[model samples]
Target: MGTDDGMQLAYYIVLLVVIGGAMLFELSGRGGQAIRQMMLWVVIFAGATLAATWWTDSGARQQVLEGGRIEIPVGRDGHFHLEAELNGVPIRFMVDTGASSIALGRDDARAIGIDLADLAYVGTAMTANGEVKTAPVTIDEIAIGDIVDRNVRAWVIGGEMDGSLLGMSYLRTFARVSFEGDLLVLER
Candidate 1:
């Protein structure tokens, strides 16, 4: 192997062994009670650190009609409820600027009582894996927080996907978009 590459691999191996040994030693200390308590404290401290990091990193707060919208905490999956519904139906959509159009999952479309057959499959979207054909449809309404839009163009993503995505098409209507760390703040 090359000298630099070999040295790097050796360093990583040594680091892992040291860390593993330390962890094992720590686990075996004080008849396991002390070790357990220590582990608990470590977990608590880690969680607190993560929470603090998320709070500080998430961008500016959004003041919508009711009150405000805050960033969703890290590791806590699902969309944040800054507001209630999108297009007259309760929806929690992840904000995705990469999407060219606002995309809705099949379930969400059905919940909103939108007829999938009426929409035309007008475009092909390039995804991470490959290309997926998308159908285009117009929603009569979409409501979030206090903001509402009418006659919005949306793409229906087929298959077992659960949630809809709010993309730049609808987001552009907002005055400002800010993200701090994991938090995305949208202002209208």
Candidate 2:
């Protein structure tokens, strides 16, 4: 075997032993109490997981709204994510009604071929982390499945944000936007 490979193997073995020793020491000091608590937590988590699975699968889910509509299911964290195409590139956006316009993070804006240095940050937006600069721009197209929009107004936010936001600007294009149970249903 190569000398470097042997050295790396030894290093990994030592690291694992150290971590295992620390865990053993901590568990031994707790006199089996820590282990019992861990087992209890595991049981509780398993029960909750099974119950949530059953609850969601129980009902006769989502009959189509008359003609047709898009239904976004709420995540376990209670947020709705819509998979969309921005300027023909696929992306995911979090549905945020509180946001006035569609706000894109730096990376996403760049991915859609926006040159950040060329844009002017003249507008400001009040966010949870305080006000931040915004550069207004028109996106050529944004599409969710068959629903497509052209020349949509959006902002490239200056500071960090969780991700792109699908705000009222886009949501308003639909005839109706409603929430039923944990689903965000959009009627076009």
Candidate 3:
């Protein structure tokens, strides 16, 4: 399972432990009030975590702050995601600092108006999912709200890709890339 899955399991374990403790307390002449309070705390903690996780990926949307800054709240899977204009078409990309360059999947490349059939998949890249063939391409324009770049070099994955990766090549254009709490901030 993924990190999120592990975390969710841990959360359930904690909840069960708390409930058990509360049951013991009630049996030891405490009362239903104590059990209720304990359950309330568990509910509150879970709600907060769920609410934070639900932000953005569930439609909170990226915030284009003033002064060329963009903030993307972390997704439920604990990764940064941004919806950017790739060749003027909106495409969601997962921020991956480990990636050397922006990597696009077949469908995303196609949506960006790339003619995949003509692409030469002579290049290769080693990813977490092993090696995959790539086709070199230069995007005419990519925009994140008001921030825009032209002639950006990216790779079109000729093999299976989990999704498009917003990698370091594009992130390097930002004057600052930092994380504030659960939000990933990119400032120009």
Q: Which candidate is the best by TM-score?
A: 3
TM-scores across all candidates? 0.57, 0.66, 0.69
Q: Arrange candidates by lDDT, highest first: which order?
A: 3, 2, 1
**Poorest 10 consecutive residues by lDDT, candidate 1:** 72-81
lDDT of 1 by residue, 44-104 (tens): 6557657865775465333453443334332244334333365567776776778777888
lDDT, candidate 2, 31-96, per-residue tens: 588667556655665576578658854642333344548887885456787778899998778889
Candidate 3 lDDT, 1-188, residue by residue in tens: 64567987798788778766766766666577666777787787678777866763375578998899999988767788899998989988999999999999998999999999999998999988789999999999998888889999999998887669999999999999999988899999
- lDDT winner between candidates 2 and 3: 3
Better of 1 and 3 by TM-score: 3
**In model 2, where do residues sit more than 4 Å from their true spots?**
1-68
For each candidate in the order shown, give its overall lDDT on alpha carbons: 0.66, 0.80, 0.87
**Per-model tally of clashing residue pairs:** 6, 0, 0
Residue pairs in clash, model 3: none
* Candidate 1 wrongly placed segments (more than 4 Å): 1-84
Q: Superposing all C-alpha atoms, what RMSD in Å does each candidate have to the true structure?
A: 10.1, 10.2, 6.5
